[model samples]
Target: MNIEANNTVNPEVKVGGQTLRWERQTIEKLLLANVREQRAARRWRMFKTLLWMALLAALVWALVAQPTLPKTPHSTGIGAGHTAMVSIKGVIADDGESSAEYILPALRSALEDSDSKALILLINSPGGSPVQAGLINDEIRRLRQKHDKPIYAVVEETCASAAYYIASAADQIYVDKASIVGSIGVLMDGFGFVDTLDKLGVERRLMTAGANKGFLDPFSPQTEEQRQFAQVMLDQIHQQFISVVKQGRGERLKETPEMFSGLFWTGEQSLQLGLADAYGSVDSVARDVVKAENLVDYSTEENIAERLAKRFGAAVGAGAVNALRSLPPLR
Candidate 1:
């Protein structure tokens, strides 16, 4: 007896002259692909969640570990004798660690405390913004007068330009024998890329609403009027610096041809010129001059976590502005 094949019950596929079951193979492949896709999606979600959690943890840690200002060294809270010390290191800018923002607060704290007999500014700087230095200088003088407490500036490596501007306001300026001392002048500086652009056959395209809006543009050809204007401004600022030095040093400054010619000198030469008073360190000034042996630092500094957070936050900004090649010159 011969039986007919059941086509409805079993589907078949012929491959290379060999019959194969089609339905089971198709179902198995589809199931495997779906499982793989699901697993990949789950893994991606887990990764995203972990990244967010890590960021949250870092934020929490930074907020919790806020930096604390250093305390003074008086045994009795409001006692008779202690020297207040504030560090003035690095470039002095409006937003920097060694600027009027931090220095004035430390000065005020030192002055307001009854136990603080005197304030000592320990300086090691190549100078920076004149405006910031002037603000700090003015505040120091005002505080000194108000509290009747002496404030001394002790130079370590360098005290030039704006740093000297600040130091000149102090009651006394002390320094190490090898320290670099003065730069009492102002200048507006820039590079001229007009020649370079001309050589490269590149034309500059700059537009401004105001006549002098792009005053110090390096790519543009410098005009005589602009040069004169800049010179006048620098001369005015230089005169102001000279006047300040004269006021601070009084008759002690020896008049010389190149004294205020934007020149620096050794600490010994500075003492000779009355730019500085004596050879001394922070320790010596605190011990011998202030008569308070204990030294406490009142320098404002960003902790590691805060710096990292700032870098992280500014990463996008940095990347966005990386292509901006043209920037204004500095004074």
Candidate 2:
């Protein structure tokens, strides 16, 4: 029995077939999952892009198309006979809310209104720029003469420095007994950083086109000549302030050594010194003094659009600064 049995296993066995099918199914599932993940990532990127685009659009709209609220009849000076009120409620600066740009228009509107019996300046501020206050004072006098309307100043909380400068223009000024009423003085304030910089080992390098251009620089020591020059300028302005107060108050002002010495006084003390007329309020003055019980505010109010535009501008400015800081430094 010369029978040679050759034992051979088939190449395409059932076990091998099963293993190949399993690997194929796993690869198909992995490919499907990868596609889904890519789609999700793309969608998220698109959403973020759209969100940024919307924010940019809104900022642009706020900047370009600053919409304002519709004026009511009272604001337009078209109402019944009333006491016209204009507010002076903050620092009197050229760029401030209490600036002449805003205040003058409201004053003119109030004075021009035929139905408005009288004009009242509702004042509550610690004062600021003398130049701005002077402008307002001049305008107040001119408008009072032109319109033949009685204008009164009703002080609240404070009526000092540049604020008193404006109040002086009024026919009469009323105040609360406890109100702070005067600081008839001018000042130029600053800080000296030369000593601090010396201690910190920092050098101040400044260039100016003119001699006095850098005279006010804090890092540089101020010359005696500069100091005297500044004092003279201040004195001249002080004289002007004194002259204005004298002219406004006339015989009503009782001259005292401390009166124009930059000393402030209480409303009661101011009354004694002729700085204020009497104790009264806006309502009382309107009802009793002007005899116009109705009140109409003719003040220029900051609108919502302006506020939003300002905030948006600030945000954009901050974002720009951050982006600049994050950039790679130049070689």
lDDT of 1 at 14: 57
- Highest lDDT model number: 2
Tally clashes: model 2. 0
Name the weakest run of 10 consecutive residues (lDDT summed) in model 2: 4-13
lDDT of 1: 0.84
Q: Which stretches of candidate 2 lie over 4 Å from their true place?
A: 1-80, 311-331
lDDT by residue (tens digit), candidate 2, 1-331: 2323233442222442342344567789999999999999999999999997887687668646653322324344455668999999989998677988889888988888778889999999999999999999999999999989999999999999999999999999999999999899999999999999999999999999988899999899999999999999999999999998988989999889999999999999999999988989999999999998898888886655576667777999999999999999999
Give lDDT tens digits, candidate 1, residues 1-331.
Answer: 3323337677665555566777888899999999999999999999999997887687778667665343433333645767878889999898678878778777777777777788899999999998998899889889989989998999999999999999999889999889999988787777889989999999899999999888799998878998899999889888988988999889889968899999999999999998999999988999999898877566667665666677777986787677464465556
Q: How far is 242's C-alpha from truth in model 2 (Å)?
A: 1.4
Question: Stretches of candidate 1 above 4 Å error?
Answer: 1-52, 64-79, 312-331
lDDT of each: 0.84, 0.87
